[model samples]
Target: MRKYLFIFKAELMSALQYVANILLHMITYFIVIIIFFYLWNYIYDDPTQLINGYSKTQMIWYVIITEIIWNIVSGRKLCRRICDDVKSGNIAYNMNKPYNYIGYILSSHLGEGIIKSLIYITFGIILGRVFLGAFPTLNVLSIVLVILSLILAVVIDTLFIIFIGLFSLYIEDANPLFWLYSKLILILGTMFPIEFFPEVIQKITTVSPIYVICYGPAKLFVDFNLNNALNIIAFQFIYLAVAFGLCGVLYAKGVKKLNVNGG
Candidate 1:
């Protein structure tokens, strides 16, 4: 645990050296938020109209929160790194390391993303204030719940990515799988709320990564129902356990296969 902390700290410190990159990412996020704000504004011609139980402000903020999660999780490229390691025979070396490779990957990825997520969140709040004139209608407790949910969401997302990356140990590449995953999240989770889709699609999404990874935290933030928050958080824990278990099984099998093949 201590060693992983040191690795995490090292990664965080190293990421600080690339502040310019993250700032560019911030600019991109801000531009996307601005576009969504205008689109929602145009759609809500009548102020009192609620589309799918979300006012224009709530809708835009939902996009903001979802985009933050999407960007933070997507930018890590965990699967690509794993693919590259396998291609370069580096996974063999990594397997022999003193630290758990998955732990190292998760810790370093979190360290890399934390600062960027913070910057994006700060700017996103400022944008919300400027354009929407207020934050989500929430007290400190609700905000805390949203924050906790977001943290768990990030973990679930990272675990999924790691699971996808581990596929490189079996196949030649995993980028295509990640590409499909990203598109699913983008369309089903980030671009709009699940309620915007057909009822059947909504039901499918609830059982998918779309529910826990992007929609759960964003929904809790923009809508803030205590019952919903508790339910989402519980589901997140279940998904986390499932994701971790699947990753462990796949990785163990992959390692065994690698050893047998003497790769």
Candidate 2:
């Protein structure tokens, strides 16, 4: 446990050391916000008319929350680290360690996710306030429900990414899989609400974990209905369990098939 925490802290310190890199990322981040701002503004045409229960201000807040959740749940570092370790044959060291490799990876990933989400969410909220007058509408209980749903979203996303990363054990290049996963998330409402989808597609999306990851929580914040918020939380947990179960099986199989070369 202590070792995992140390590794997480070390990774965070390394990330912070590149101050210019962080600032560059922030710039790109703001560019995305601006692009979405104009895009949504154009889509609605009339900002006053509510579309699918979201006003322009609420829509901007939804984007902000979605961006934050997308960053946290995507596990970008985890995928890259797994690819690097596999390519460099450094994963052999992890295999020999007494600690569970999956758990160690998850903890480190969660640490990075926490830091990135905090930075982006804080910046986004401040930016939204300045430019869009966007703010969350949830009361105390709804806020609690949103938090729980977000945590479940993180768990489901982590499991899915871990499963995806395990493909490195079998394939020489997992980058394609990573790219496909990212594209799916982007297209499946991680960046926007599922309401943008056609009615048939939107119906399908209601059961997808991607919808729970961002859209559901964004809805909770924008609407603040207790019953619906509770339902979203429940659905998040259900998907979390399903994702984790599948990952457990995949991890077991992938570890057994791991080939450590030049060790």
Candidate 3:
């Protein structure tokens, strides 16, 4: 446990060195929300009018929260790192390490995400307020709930991306897989709330990772609801367990295969 904490601290320090890069990404993020602001404004002639149960303010805030979550997790980069590890035979070096690979990755990502989360989340709130007014209902309880949900969401997202990256052992490439996964989440819930979709699709997404990953925290932050908060957090925990289990199983199998093949 202490060793993992060391890894986390090391990564946190390393990430601090890249603060400038993160801020550069924030610039792009600002541009994105601006576009969304204008687009949503045009879609709704009345700012107060609700579409899919979200006023313009709520919708834009939801997107901002989602984008913040996406940028913090940065699943694509993690996936590529894992793929590179496998391709370069670097994973074999870790086989002799005392720490579990999955735990190491999770801890490292959490550390890396901490700084970005602070920056992006802070920027996201200001952007929402400046462009779309403040979050309709901001309270201490709501803030706590949203923070918890976001933590679970990012952990679950990192584990799942690790799972996908582990597939590099079997597939010739995993980037395409990550691309599809990211796109599906974006289309289903990140860019637009599930309510905007047809009932059938909404039901599917509500049960999918997007429910907890992209939609859960954003929804809770946008509109505070105790019932929804409990449900999303509960689902996030379940998904977290599932994702971690999958990574462990895949990592173990991939290692066994490599050993058998005389790597």
Quantify all predictions' global Cα lDDT against the true fold.
Answer: 0.87, 0.76, 0.88
Candidate maximizing TM-score: 3
The total number of steric clashes, by the backbone 3 Å criterion, in model 3 comes to 0
Global lDDT for candidate 1? 0.87
TM-score of each: 0.94, 0.89, 0.96
lDDT of 2 at 242: 85
lDDT of 3 by residue, 57-86 (tens): 888988999998889989899999888877
Best candidate, lDDT-wise? 3
Instruction: Flag the better candidate by TM-score, 2 or 3.
Output: 3
Against the true structure, candidate 3 reaches a TM-score of 0.96
lDDT of 3: 0.88
User: Whose TM-score is higher: candidate 1's or candidate 2's?
Assistant: 1
Candidate 2: Cα lDDT at 48: 86
Per-residue lDDT for 59-124 in model 2, tens only? 787777777777666567668778788778888898788877777787777766666666776787
Q: Could you give candidate 1's per-residue lDDT for residues 116-190 as a string of tens digits?
A: 788888888888888888787899999999999998998899989999888888888888998988889888999
Model 1 alpha-carbon drift over 4 Å, by segment: 259-263
For every candidate, C-alpha RMSD to the true structure in Å: 2.0, 2.3, 1.7
